[model samples]
Target: MTDPASPARPVAAAIRYLSIIVGCACLLLAAVCFAIACQVFIQTGVFAQSYVMVGLISAALGLLALTLSRVWK
Candidate 1:
């Protein structure tokens, strides 16, 4: 019979990796949105409010993901 602890190891590792990936993706999206906001500012001399909003949301998501990853263990 297989050891009961064996299957859980891979699942936990997968969750940890997934959390890290998602966190990084969120941060990257935030950066992209922030870049767009900057471009809008440069071209129009006015802030693109929507871009700023999205960037904030992405940043929050990233932070949440990172937090979850760290705490999962």
Candidate 2:
């Protein structure tokens, strides 16, 4: 059992909130990057693989963060 007045509790909650925020932001950024990649591909012959790679990495990280946040507590 944990104490309601513990200082660690507040810090942990803050970290969880921050993690959720970061996860959402990363997911949003990944979507934008993927959209841009598609536009770039359609306008030009280039595949824009770098943008796709970035999007994939961001998605993975975002999911991992969100999952870890839930699992932490």
Candidate 3:
């Protein structure tokens, strides 16, 4: 006779794997956003001359979102 808990093992494993995949995706997206923002700053030079704070804020927000999504249960 099979243990009752054995039947649910596959489902649990699938959920865990899916969650990890989603977390990685979020992180990857955030990285891309950060890279783009850096490129824009470098190309425009406007941010450097004027509002450096805004660029920093945007980067921080992207990082926060990535962290939250990854840790979400």
lDDT of 2 by residue, 1-63 (tens): 988898998888888998999899889989998999999999997999999999999999899
Task: Give Cα-based local distance difference scores for all models.
Answer: 0.92, 0.90, 0.57
Over 4 Å off, model 3: 1-5, 46-73
Q: Kindly indicate the candidate among 2 and 3 with the higher TM-score.
A: 2
The best candidate by TM-score is 2
Query: For each candidate, what TM-score against the reference?
Result: 0.87, 0.92, 0.55
Better of 1 and 2 by lDDT: 1
Task: Give the per-residue lDDT digits (tens) of candidate 1, residues 1-73.
Answer: 6566888778877898899999999999999999999999999999899999999999999999989889885
Give the Cα-based TM-score of candidate 2 against the true structure: 0.92
Poorly placed runs, candidate 2 (over 4 Å): none
Compose the digit string of candidate 3's lDDT tens values, residues 1-73. 6566785767656666665666565556556666666777789854442233444555566566556546653
Comparing 1 with 2 on TM-score, the higher-scoring candidate is 2
**Model 3 whole-model lDDT (C-alpha atoms):** 0.57
What's the CA error at residue 4 for candidate 3, in Å? 6.4
| Candidate number of the best lDDT | 1
> Once model 3 is optimally superposed onto the true structure by TM-score, how far is the C-alpha of residue 59 displaced, in angstroms?
10
TM-score of 1: 0.87
Lowest summed lDDT window (length 10), candidate 2: 64-73
